[model samples]
Target: MADIEERRPRNKATTFLLVLAAAAFVVASALRLLGIDGTRHMVATTALVPYFTAAGVLLGAIALLARRWFVGTVTLLVALVLVAAVAPRAFPDARPIGVGQEVRVMAANLLVGKADAEVLVAAVRDHAVDVLALQELSPAMVVDLERAGLDEVLPHRVFLAEPGASGSGIASRYPLTARDLAGPSTLRQAGALVALPGADLEVVSVHPLPPVTPDGPEPWQRDMAGLPRPDLNGPYRVLAGDFNATLDHVGLRRLLNHGYVDAADQVGAGLDPTWPADAVWPPPVVIDHILVDDRCPVDTFQVVDIPGSDHRAIVSQFVVPAR
Candidate 1:
């Protein structure tokens, strides 16, 4: 009787922890599903839905192993909700193989004009990138990039090189013509039409305002909503750069709904993180992306490390269907 009583407190404590874990899982799942982006911090938290969901699954499994049937079952159910939410992105539709010309694209944000020009140029050269989308470009960085022989690799270019986060540019091996896109007035997002041999592709370098302050959330939402949507029947499209939103963000998800798919997600690499490259721990979220239309089939997607930038670069090989 004495031994049983001594174990009772431990059992109660365990039960309490299990219940707490389950409740946290339920709350996180609900917040993500609900797509609440009303506040700045909430929007930032939304970016971590996948991580939260993953934690829930781990805790639920632990509960199950401990034979806490009721707690285990409830936690598992909550965890399952997260699994369902991420299933579409984690396992996207299979892409068609051997149907189009290959186009390799690389995108990177320069950390408000702080990325190394030589490192950026090296990435383009080493990766043999056909198109390079850069955000947070500055006049000085543009000069440095040009001096680093970026022009030799990607001769055709369109750029709006400014200071701070409101700068973007595109460099392509093929001819490029500037195209206007609707977005926030303050952000320096730019679009260009790349005239390929047999097909035309619209590539946009986007850098939405980060949601970090009390007034940042609304503009961030507006910036995402303002991005141009691809015409499914028209030219092939690719939107790349630091979007300041993750797959978990409803705004980015809504953008994807407009006949576009994330290149990394399509290739089963959706869980890779791309921001805070210099973090002490591994980056926790993927804010950079290569979003392509269905007309373009993704072959492979990779996240490349760039020195002096807070965000890593995304390199994707896309097969644009021949017109």
Candidate 2:
């Protein structure tokens, strides 16, 4: 009887310890699902949402094995906290980035759909976007976009040679006398469109490969590093489009390290969430963005939705700061 009593306590202790460890895992799992840990790889991981979802399940299994109530609760809390930090960054900034000049640029991914084109074109006309970058555009769609009445508003333009991959295009209110656009190195389209916009600015619209896997981020990074990165002492520059990763992602973090500021965050109230346009179910992560050099200041930022595509349009109002 005494041996049984002693064994019972020891068994309970072992169970408690196992449960405690499982609880910690549960927390980690929850955090990952809530989209808490924004890493260079997280965007691609969105494709296998089940793997992330399984993390929570595995953690719960551990908690059940151990039966540690307090441990489980704490783990859950920790997981929830991590997600809370990331979830909030998804919105637009309630305040403007700078008080220098006001310019608006709109970027949308038109998934080769007529209805999306129609809706996005209407939004562009309504908002009077000053600068625009579009991705996943077909040759047919490009012709249609140019004909959609933005010609008078955004008369200046830059486009690429379609080497079979979906092309990227740019339109602007400022005059683009000439361009230097290089087509995609791999599957994604990336290029610089030189324009003489009032002064001297080197604006680039890039659509790096969507980070669908580890293989994706690498080539895009290599190509980006090779670009004629803006000169420090000279002109105002901007790189905007569907970069396919969030701010915490490595490539983006590197760009920020190189001094590119997020254009949307500059003039928004954290109200800019652009990718996965199902705002109702909202897998709507902020994959599309506008990033500008320090010389430009942002005035307003908003996300516009396209009818048939998965990404919303990124619209920003900003201009080159006084020298």
Candidate 3:
């Protein structure tokens, strides 16, 4: 009788904990599905939906092993929903091949102008990067990049070089004509038209302000909304840099809805994290991106490490279709 009573309490405790954990998962799943993160905390939490999906699967398995059929079913359904949202990103989608021109684009946040210039220039030369978009650019960093032979390989430039993080620049192997993309934001976003062989491709170095405070998300959301939409009638457009947002963020998904496709997502590298590269806390997240028009077929995508930078470099090759 004594042993039976002890086991009963222990079983109840386990059930209670299981229910609590299941509730958390349910909430997370709901937030992900709704895509209405209005505050900084909620926005940060939504970024971890991929991790929650993994937890949901494990929770479901545990519940089933303990014969808690109701909890097991619920958790499994939540896991399915999360999986359905993120799994396609793991598999490459069928993209049409373009026989016109091959263009390699690379974007890197310089960690407030502190990333290694020599390494970045080497990456450009090694990867044959035709257009390079740089964020967190500074005047000294521009000088450093040139000293490291950036100008030799990518001579054409459009710079909004500042002393601090509010700076952006684009260097291209081909000529760059300044394209106006000014906006009411904190970051110095830049844009230019790349004179390619057959077309003048428009490339924007994007860096939206991050949602850090309670009132910060509003401005961040505004910056996201203000991003230019891809025009099919115009030249091919590629937006690259640290967006301060992720695929799970409704803002980014909304931008993608406007005829833009994330290069990493199209190539099965969507889940790859790009921020907080050298940090131990906050793990890592995918905030840097190379967003191209839907017509441009991505051939290759890579996340590269640059010493002293908090964000990884995203280098991608795209085949721009004949216009």
Candidate 4:
């Protein structure tokens, strides 16, 4: 009788813990699904949806092993919800045949002029990147890139190369005409029109503030919302750089809602992380991206490592229809 009572308390304690864990997961899952991140912490928290999905699976298994059938069922349901949200990213989608200009675009954050200039230039050369969008660019980095033969690979340029992280720029194998895409952003988010063979591509180097800033998520949200929307009648557009927000964020999602598709997501490589490259803590997350007009077909997507930078560069190839 004594042993039975002792075990009963222990069983109840286990059940309580499991239920608490399940509730936390359910809340997180719901936040991601509904896209309700009002606070900076919530914004940062929701970026871990992929990790949440994995954790939910483990949690469900633990509940089942504990013989907590009800908890197990609920946790598994939450896991299912997460899986439904995340699984599609792992499989490629049927892309339309692109019989137009083939553009190899790449975006990299220079970590405020600290990323390896030679390595970045080499990536541009090896990948044959037609357009390179850069964030956190500096005038010194510009000189370094040119010294490293970036101008030879992608000669045309439009840059707002300040000394700090506020700077941004674009370089292209084709001619580039600068376009102002100024918004409520602390960074100089620059844009240019790439004069391609048969079509012009409006490319923007995007870098909205991180939600984890001292000012909070409002500025970040505003910047994201203020980003240029896709116009079907206009030239095909591509926005690339350190977005600082993932597809899971409502800000990014809202921007995507306007006829834009993530290049990585289009080809099932969406879950690949592009931030915190050199660090062990905070794991890694996909904060950088290449968003294009939905009409464009993405061919190949790759995330390349840049030495001395905390961000990995995303290189993508796609075709824009010639009008």
Ten-residue segment with the worst summed lDDT in candidate 3?
A: 179-188
Instruction: Tell me the RMSD of model 4 versus the true structure.
Output: 1.1
- Compared to the true structure, candidate 2 yields what TM-score? 0.70
| Best candidate according to lDDT | 4
Instruction: For residues 213-302, write the lDDT of model 4, one tens digit per residue.
Output: 878988888778778988777888999999899888898888788888899988999998999996767979999999988889988899
Candidate 1 lDDT score relative to the true structure = 0.85
Sorted on TM-score, highest at the top, how do the candidates line up?
4, 3, 1, 2
Candidates 2 and 3 compared by lDDT, better number: 3
Which candidate order results from sorting by lDDT in descending order?
4, 3, 1, 2
For candidate 1, the clash count comes to 0
Question: What are the runs in model 4 whose C-alpha is more than 4 Å off?
Answer: none
Q: 189-307 in candidate 1: lDDT tens per residue?
A: 88999998888999999888888766768887778888888886778888999988888888888988888889989988898889888684633688999999866788889998888
For residues 220-314, write the lDDT of model 2, one tens digit per residue. 65555543445688666777777776654556656767877787655434435666777545444566777777556666677776777778777
Candidate 3 per-residue C-alpha lDDT over 1-323 given as tens digits, one digit per residue, 9 for 90 to 100: 99999899889999999999999899878877998876788888888888888999999999999989999999999899889988888888888867778999999999889999999999999999999999999999998998999989999999999988899999999999998764566788899999999887999999988887656588888888888888878888898999888898998999899889999999999999998897757958889999998988988899999997999999999998777
Error of 4 at 195 (Å): 0.6
- Which regions of candidate 2 fall more than 4 Å away from where they truly are? 1-43, 46-101, 113-115, 161-165, 177-184, 187-198, 213-217, 224-230, 267-272, 279-282
Better of 2 and 3 by TM-score: 3
Clashing residue pairs, backbone N/CA/C < 3 A, model 4: none
